[model samples]
Target: MSSHADHPTVIVGAGPAGLTAALCLARYRHRVIVVDSPGAPRNSASAGVHGHIGMDGVTPAEFRARAWRELSRYTTVERLEDEAEGVSSAPDGGFRVALGSGGTVQAGTVLLATGVVDVHPADVDGFAECWGRSVIHCPFCLGEENAGGSWATVADNAELAGMSAVAFRAWSEDTIAICPETMPGLETARATARSGGGDVVTGTVRRLRHREGALHGIELADGRVLERQTLVWTPRQRQQPVVQRVADELKLTVDEAGFVAVDASQSTGVPGLYAAGDLTSRWKQSVTASTAAGAAAADAIHMAALLAAVHH
Candidate 1:
């Protein structure tokens, strides 16, 4: 039987949250192993990290590279460029994390920082090309850069559309909500939009017209074209597979929106299993917020370990 190596903590994702936790734990002289796979970060298409103090406008790739560089200073942190396949309870009152590349690591505590995936509008053509650029989701993340431009929101529901239109007026005066025919409460949404100095157009968006990744406008099924330079839509999001797997394996409580239920300390209520970042939050999905959550989880783990040692 192959023996599994042990660590103080194991982080399942190496995005902002995971990296931050690893850095914090390492700085405190705790041994941690981070398992992550390339091309899995959801923000790869984003041009830069927005609303993050000091690191604002830094590209996602650059931000991760710099974080890894800083983490290299600590010998206690080990980063594996591999996917975390599964997690199981270990005999020693810990957890065993299985890596896709083959091997297992026993961890006294586990921090799942795996983020969520954005589900783009499948019916809208050319959306994939303009995503993270001209077609964005979060207003706070990409609104300032495209301020003053013609903005529109393709919302899934009337309430969301109305709310988005109102919020978008801060960025541009000419804000409109492209309410699809399937959306409910169209009149209410339109009223809300007009109240906020915006308009609501009920139509089926056929496709997005873009040239070389720059959005030109959106074409409607009724052959109407809305000449908008920028489009904002709140895409549906789903948790990553690793997050769901771990949550199920450990029987962690998850909210209706599929976010892991965590306490103020980022604990999942499953003893040493913790979760942070987008996997556990939806309101504030920014680099700064995720990093803060990671740091908080790390501090909690460190304190728990200290108490355990003292009692021992």
Candidate 2:
């Protein structure tokens, strides 16, 4: 039901990884379609692309802009604005990708660039409202924002203090790694905290107290109020594999950690099917994802050439 039903390659996301793949494939004169999801990855739980070599400190919006500038060079590249529902396998060894609009993009191969989103803690006052503002998940993203402000690193686990406190103290001289109840590492991290001239708080944070859209402080369970303007924590992430659903010919092999098993070139268990970026279930940065996407696309082209030779 797609307007361009017979495209040779269909990309599922318009993210940096997806767009980069599309731009490369289009330069090779491969028929490509890029489906744009309604929401940008920046709008979600992702802070920024980390570990980029040249673009190490670039923000998410800056990364997206640079990618878009390159993508605009292609006139043959077809871009669709829809959320990919799932991908199905075709009898001819291709793929049929279902879109939310009840259409399907049939392609010879599929690549997924959609990344994972981090899980946040439950409703603890301004927890949700302060996202990307006063509350941050990654130290690299929000560390500079809360500089010189009283900061708190609230962890569900106590052991995170050693690492979190070490990292947090770089931006804030006054950092407290708080856990609800005392377990272990309370002393060690607390000692480490004092070494960095920081305080250790064992109070159960009832809620994040904020006013005027800026973080004010935290309300403690025992009615003790703490004066901290910024909070940081690390959370887990969840991924949706888009390519595996459509390519019935390909077999997905994931690790015990639920990451897709791939070769050096990022090829999956299937021949024509390749995945790049966060879809491989790897802990990724922009540089890694971009390098992986280029490598996978090159591998796919080589395989395609070999297949053409066999047929010829």
Candidate 3:
């Protein structure tokens, strides 16, 4: 077992990205500590992860467990149930990472796998009322769960209304793309929806309607109500960094999406700092997220080892 205090790299987040990064760093004999913040829920937006290449159908629990089981064999790795709050530079050119519980991690480097989140109205008109059971975000994750049942997509981005429609159609036989415009693509979308046993409607969704905790309909802005069992949307990705204030202190470059800019190895604008996973707009899939993490961890370990050799 590794002493948590001895870890050279402190990783923030315990999701697929963070866990994968931790395993990679541990393989290089770098003591690693993983902090999840609130941890992951079973019904998390990401139901399962992919892109493991050799491993598929890896559930969240199984993915973490297998990595943890193996990471323990290589070097010191500790899984802590704490939310990383902030990080700053140390006088000796190392780093100080703080947690919500007032715990601190002293390290030569920090790996931020804090991931991105798509914001949705919290239960507006009872949408929250049917989440997980009926209302959902990803079609690939929940389409089969409601197979043969009715489903619809809410158009948030006018430009990508067709994207959601096509995604929904590919997932289920019954799908619809809801938009305010009766554009030419709607016909194509509608036809595609029909091929999947779905339809297209034009209206602004006011709220999701539910009864007995089951999704039954959606309320429109004009007061007309449409009945549907499921609501889907391709989230406009929003990236939130864990160290926004500190980034400015360190003069880091952030993109318009608010993600820390990175190179091939996930090195950021600041030295001794790296980022990976959903933190960048690389892609929204679990596989890409994990791969980014591994890349970042490998880079961190390599860089740290090189720095240590220089001093020696």
Candidate 4:
């Protein structure tokens, strides 16, 4: 058996949460190894990171590049571009993390920052072509860029349709809520949309109409088309495979949405196992929220280590 390589902490996933935690821990002179895959991040489709203060409008790729460059200043922080295959608790109060690259490491603590994957709207032609540019999920993230433009919100249910219609109105006066006929609470949603100076349509969206990657409209199954310059739709999300594996291995409790359950301090109930970002939160998936959670986890870890050393 290969000997266990050791570190103070091991962070899985290199998105905002993991990177932020790694940076915070490294600043405290803790040894942190960040393991991440080369796959695209959840927000890779976003044109910029919104409501991130200094980083407003920064592209996801550029944000990561800048973070990694900053991390280079801290020698205690190490990064490995490999996927984590498995994780298990060691006998000595550490964690054994197995990598897909056939390597392993033992760490005093583990932070699962593995983010969620979005399930896009199915059977929508041309939607994929303009996903990030003209089609978006969060109005707060991309609303300002397309302000005053014709917008449409496709909801899977009446509640969401109502909520989104009102929210989208903040960005564009010409907003419409589209709901399938089968969805319940159609009247309620329609009422809310009308109250917000928007209109509601009940029909199955057949496809998206786009010209050269720019979204132009949405077509209904009944052959009617609504002219729209932007589309906002929330895709169902699922936790990454690595997160599920870790949860099962450690028997960690997860919320109904499959997000790892953590306390306000970001502790995962299991000793030395923590989680942050989208894997632990759904409603607040912004960059600022993730960064805050990561920093809080680092603080908790630092305090725990201090108490341990003093007792020892």
| lDDT (Cα, 0-100) at 215 in candidate 1 | 85
Q: Which candidate, 3 or 4, would have the higher lDDT against the true structure?
A: 4
Name every residue pair that clashes in candidate 4: none
Which candidate comes out best when scored by lDDT?
Answer: 1
> What ranges in model 1 sit over 4 Å off?
1-6
When 2 and 3 are scored with lDDT, the better candidate is: 2
The CA root-mean-square deviation of candidate 4, after full C-alpha superposition on the true structure, stands at: 3.0
lDDT tens digits by residue: candidate 1, 104-191: 8888899999889898878889889989989988889998988987988887688877776678778899899888776779889889
What is the number of backbone collisions in each predicted candidate, taken in the order shown?
Answer: 0, 3, 2, 0
As a whole number from 0 to 100, the lDDT of residue 184 in candidate 2 is 71
TM-score of 2: 0.79
**TM-score of candidate 4 on Cα atoms, chains taken together:** 0.94
lDDT assessment of candidate 4: 0.85
* Candidate 2 backbone collisions, by pair: 87-245, 87-246, 88-246
lDDT against the true structure, per candidate, is: 0.86, 0.68, 0.67, 0.85
Q: Any idea what lDDT model 1 has?
A: 0.86
Q: Mind giving the per-residue lDDT tens digits that candidate 4 earns over 1-312?
A: 111224569999999999999999988888989997888887887788989989999999999999999999988888989999888988877899999989888888999888888887677787778887888878778888878879998886777777665677778888888888878888988898788788778887878889876888899989999999998877789888888888897899998888889998899999899999988877888888899999999888888887777787
- Whole-model lDDT, model 2: 0.68
